[model samples]
Target chain A: MRMTDRPSNEEGALAPWFAAGREAAPLPSGEFMARMEALALESQPAPRAAPAAPARQSRGPGRLLARLRAMGGWPALAGLTAACAMGLWIGAAAPEAAVDWVATATQEQGLSGLDPASGFDYAMLGL
Target chain B: MPYDAMTDTSDEQLLAAYAAGAPGAARALTARLGPLAFGHAFRMLRDRAEAEDVAQEALLRLWRAAPGWREGEAKVSTWLYKVVSNLCIDRMRRRRGGFAALEDVAEPADPAPSAAARLQERSRAEALEGALAALPDRQKQAVVLRHLEGLTNPEIAAIMDIGVRAVESLTARGRKALEGLLAPRRADLGYEDD
Candidate 1:
């Protein structure tokens, strides 16, 4: 249909008709507004308190330990310490076993062994 | 600032105030958005209770999102219109029966005049609404947002998530369909008198 056939103003040919509709169908009742306000208030977040002053700033190992504690507390720190100790022991005691395991796994997958200097043999893999 | 000062605040600022737990911000936001949402939903669904539910849910979502409401991202009214439109469309999809006929739909009482002219005006509005209800969902939405809600084509496009060209096409087709539907009642609607 041609746009020119309709009223050329803001609401087309039915602007006055719609205006009457709007007047007849006004906004929701006061009860609806009350319910909405209640719902909105119910969902509104609680106000945040202002930040408190810090006691002291940590430095060096103290800061590192604080960071670890903040991450997951004593258990996490202990776990990290245990992991580092295990790594040291494995490197010192069973380096050959680790290398053999890597080489065997890669060979089984039809891949080359690791280069000690640069990790994987990307050249052999045609990279 | 005091909570009463929020009456003149922008929607974004009012939302921020609401997130900050200001005293009157919730009421302010509700008062501002409730009518617009309800009116749009009512126009779409033509059921007062269902439209009320849709409006409440839409505002509830806005309240939930207020904490993370980023300023300057979009106009708050635009966002609410998008939400209301989606909810209305979903309700329309789940509708099992045909559109409500004019007599079946509840009419809000006209308090203006007790004369025949008032009756005719009421019928004209109802007829337009019925014609609107008979339209396909997208076309109905496009026409409602364009004509009744007085939104620009670009704003309708953003709300409907379609291109401006698509909005234009939907509204054009919707207007044509509406004209055809209302043609039979043109005299009753007093178009002949015009």
Candidate 2:
């Protein structure tokens, strides 16, 4: 067959050559396939289960809020709010007292106003 | 599907089954895609050992990508062809001292009944392989995929990441070059007539 001729499935100049090539085409040996299968199995990600039907989540923020309300209601909310308010008030009103308490604690621990270098040295001793 | 049922399933479905961790999908894929990958690599590399490595590595990548594989994006074989092609190219680039001369590459032993005919066949195959090796990388790849692997121009284009026209041109040029290379040995290769 001429070079310009398209290669066809039927017998032609190139057909024998292609046939030989195909016959000579190297197949993976059984050992090679086994190794590849092992590698594939090893590399394969563990299958994720079908997600457990999404756990039947509460539909919306409204529903979630409603559930929370049903569990605790306004009394619980009021108590939590009061406790937060009390904590904030103490923080704002007793800043100096808080600072003094921190200072006292540090002094008792022998770390009062220590410079970073001294702190590092002290930390080096596993304190 | 049952393991027996998977035998007749498409490659895409097999890959999906593999991704889903079906019990038999790994074996199914191995039995299916492993030979294609090996043949392609062996044709490209002309070295059985390296080809085996390339095939295993290609399959390993497939396994790693199975979980994230997007079905219907491309045929599993096409995806594998692309991967094997690129891997072979990478290996060729990293080969020390350049491409091995044809004489240095070993040919597999043939088992034909007649020694003379077997030798001639072996020599013909080796000559073709040598000619193929001498081709520029793209032309060689195009020719191998187009002719030896029996893939369509479009499929080859997809694997080589080129347009169909480009694939056609490359294959044509490759065949012409092969014709020139092998013409002088026509009689020896038992192609005496034309």
Candidate 3:
């Protein structure tokens, strides 16, 4: 800011004219002030919360979402869902041969047979 | 802050308060700057209606800019000066009548005791305005901001987006041009009476 503090004697003889100009400087009318005040108030940015995140429901729609995209989207998700349901159904009602083999193979190892869904059978049988 | 209490606040603080939706902050801002902006525009554009539009537009922009307004980066008045000047220049460039529009300018009559002196003062002012209007846009802006508006060179530099030396040069040239234009009418405008 190594500049002069103010404009120098450039006005000189023109000083009187400049003085008149300043004296004659326009005064705004009441209508203008009111209009400006209203505009200022109207244009104020309201105190608002940060914008609502579009993913408000899901906290981290990040890596999992990217993984879903990589796995071929909703169709792949549907396929995966169907596979899970089938796996649960088959595990509950597996072939008795498989259960027998598990019992025989694990007897020496002192492990019991896998007997998932046996409770449901007992409840149905009333024994 | 309340409207009354904001009288002593800096323009930046007032603007921040307005941005935060503080009650009466907007009114405070308008009250503080409305006349400053309007006077500059009126002197630049001459027509009261056009001046009002430019002033309103600049203040409106200031309001919109309030939220992101960085303190210490620039003064609010400087920003308004820049905006108002540019808007007036734009209007001036679009219209083809030169300073013939001076006829449409509104001059408030002085309440001086001597009617003759008042008329003479008005004539001096009008002569000055006519000379000012004849100047190139940059020169007129520099001169007005310097002599008439009484802004410092640094403030004028910020407002004009130019360097201090450049502001100095423009005002110098403008003042010279004005002197030459108004020289012949010195006695006619009652400067001799002074």
Candidate 4:
């Protein structure tokens, strides 16, 4: 019979050879293990250097004042005030605020002479 | 397995302890992974002398990597496997023609019928080793791991850093190629004895 006709397990004559190969195989032991461990340890990346500590400057009234000014100078105060005003304008222009303001304005001044409510809201007309 | 000096805690655990400055953990890990690692190196290197050197270098790498080995990331075996495979690949490239895979290089052909058959068989097997050595790097590795070392596809894949499907393909191809290579000599290997 052709070798292909024999199933792998039925290749009985070859079994002993296979078994011998398996049996004679070496096990992981002794000097071999030590050598592998050494190789493994060698492959590790080197440790990083510790970061340098930040330089310390003397702290007193002068330094404190300087830090405060850096944080909140006149330009910063002006920018903050402008930001707050813009926030107020944005808040007033919100749908809810717009609705309220329009209602109050319409009540105070009839539809003829009206303060333009930020933008038109047809929801006020129940549309 | 009995948790003896031979085989105890896992390599990962030992590495963790070693990272934490447990002085003995390195030796423990060395004992555990040593044989398989050396065998792997030997298989690729095909030279006992070079295999031994590579194995030593590989373990030294493990020792160096130990201190910074982050906890709970990758298994120690997985890490070692990749390192060893890469090292073997590099060594194989650097010294391509240095070693032959088989221990028994050229057994004498027997003069007597009974003695001759045995000697011829040994020589045939040794010659097959040269053919096995001639297989491509990945195919050789797959064959060695799957058949000789008895590693499963997943283990081989993890060591190879490839998908399981790829490992299967490599092993299947390797086996089929080996069978083809060895088929004509089947009777000589005593396959037809029965």
Instruction: Please give, for residues B1-194, the per-residue lDDT of candidate 4 as tens digits.
Output: 22235355777777766666554555566666677667777756556677677666676777776777777777777666667778888877676764443443455334345675555545554545555676777877776666656666677788888897898788667666666666666676566764
- Model 1 alpha-carbon drift over 4 Å, by segment: A1-12, A51-127, B1-7, B97-115
Residue-level error in angstroms, candidate 2, position B126: 2.3
Model 3: how far residue B78 lies from native, Å: 0.4
- Measured against the true two-chain complex, the DockQ scores of the candidates, in the order shown, are 0.27, 0.25, 0.43, 0.12
Candidate 3: C-alpha lDDT: 0.83
The DockQ-based CAPRI class assigned to model 2 is acceptable
Candidate 4 stretches greater than 4 Å from native = A1-19, A27-127, B1-8, B97-105, B108-128
For residue B167, model 4's alpha carbon misses the true position, in angstroms, by 1.4
Local distance difference test scores for all models:
0.81, 0.79, 0.83, 0.63
lDDT tens string, model 4, A22-122?
A: 44444555565555555444543344445988877677866876866997876887898899999898787677977788888888777733745423455
lDDT of 1 by residue, B1-194 (tens): 65545566888888888999877888888888999999999999888899999999899899888988888999999999999999999999899366555445445355356677777777777878888888889999998887778788888899999998899899889888877777777776687897
Instruction: Using lDDT as the measure, name the better of candidate 3 and candidate 4.
Output: 3
Q: What is the lDDT of residue A38 in candidate 2?
A: 85
Model 3: pairs clashing at backbone N, Cα or C within 3 Å:
none
Interface RMSD of each: 4.2, 3.6, 2.0, 7.1
Give the interface RMSD of candidate 4: 7.1
